[model samples]
Target: MLNRERYRGRLIDHIGLVVRDFAASKAFYTAVFKALNIPIGGSDERNLWADELFISTSDSDEVEGHLTGRIHLAFQAQDRAMVDAFYRAAMAQGGRDNGAPGERSYHPGYYAAFVLDPDGNNIEAVFRGASERSAAAVRIRY
Candidate 1:
């Protein structure tokens, strides 16, 4: 069994993505996550997981020979520079740029960048200006 710990965020429990090309998706996400300063919690040939995101090949039990539809996931970044790094790393790892990093009309200091993952999922890195969080994450062990 895979030894792992869970870090819960404010609103989401977890998200799973089933991909066709596991290796490509893994490489793409690994680089992108690294740029965002998130570590790979645990992984094997069939599974890759981080804090709240779980990715698997279609052959995995959770996938059962199925593929997930394109979905959008926005990750939090420390600052605009991190968002830029995410774009650069993702581009070097087969990610397509959906949107360049910039302030959005969503609100002031809403800096973010968008990229399409190997599976065409819209992935994003966003930095919402200066703010404070209650905690880094809620830790859970199993």
Candidate 2:
């Protein structure tokens, strides 16, 4: 018999986003990361020597000048306090706040905060804990 209970999946490794101008996108992502106090892993800008490449000069051009199909990306936070800090920093760095740091009961103790990046991407920081629900309830009820 297999011991299914012993199986545990590790956290996510990394995420990728295609940008029109690598320099501009790098700067924007770097700013948000600095605000959140998350170290950037790495990035690169290389020309693809292939035929089926659809490279564009800018993100808007890549997406046909419309902010459609916005991408949502979330990062794991160490704790609720970290989530709060991330939200504050993001707002301070010109990120638009979508949701404040608090519990999302719909997700079972999910404490998260959301923000919009310079390019209108939805970014979030989240932590998992039961205390988050109680705190959220207090804020909501009061």
Candidate 3:
């Protein structure tokens, strides 16, 4: 399981991506995430994935009435190398590039790369440069 405490202060709690083609999207995400050392938390009904990014098909009950596949999702990279690897893996998996890896004026250490998934969603791998986080994570004893 992911350490939810690590995501504190983020505006969004979680996000879901409703894709058109399940198989392609799954393969693409799996490959890219593997390059980043993130695991595939879980899967649902062979048509959905319950990971950091909850991927579902348009036929899903919750998204049946909605049109999806248009959004920008950025994944955190441990370093610039990981961002580069993510771009390579994503492209090797048939993804299209939106931007190459580089530093951004968004902030002093903001580096990112962007790609378009098979379903047209913009996916990014970003390295926020060297900086200390406020907390290691929210900890608790179970």
Best by lDDT: 1
lDDT of 1: 0.91
lDDT of 2 by residue, 32-51 (tens): 56655565433335211111
Clashing residue pairs, candidate 2? none
lDDT, residue 1, candidate 2: 12
Where model 1 places Cα greater than 4 Å from the true spot, the runs are none
- What tens digits encode model 3's per-residue C-alpha lDDT throughout 19-50? 77788888899889888777675656544443
How far residue 122's Cα lies from its native spot in candidate 2, in Å, is 0.8
After TM-score superposition, what is the CA distance of residue 91 in candidate 2 from its true location, in Å?
0.8
Better of 1 and 3 by TM-score: 1
Q: How does candidate 2 score on lDDT?
A: 0.56
TM-score of 2: 0.56
Scored against the true structure, residue 23 in model 3 reaches a CA lDDT of 86
The lDDT of model 3 is: 0.77
Q: Against the correct fold, how does model 1 do in TM-score? A: 0.95
Lowest lDDT 10-residue stretch of candidate 3: 1-10
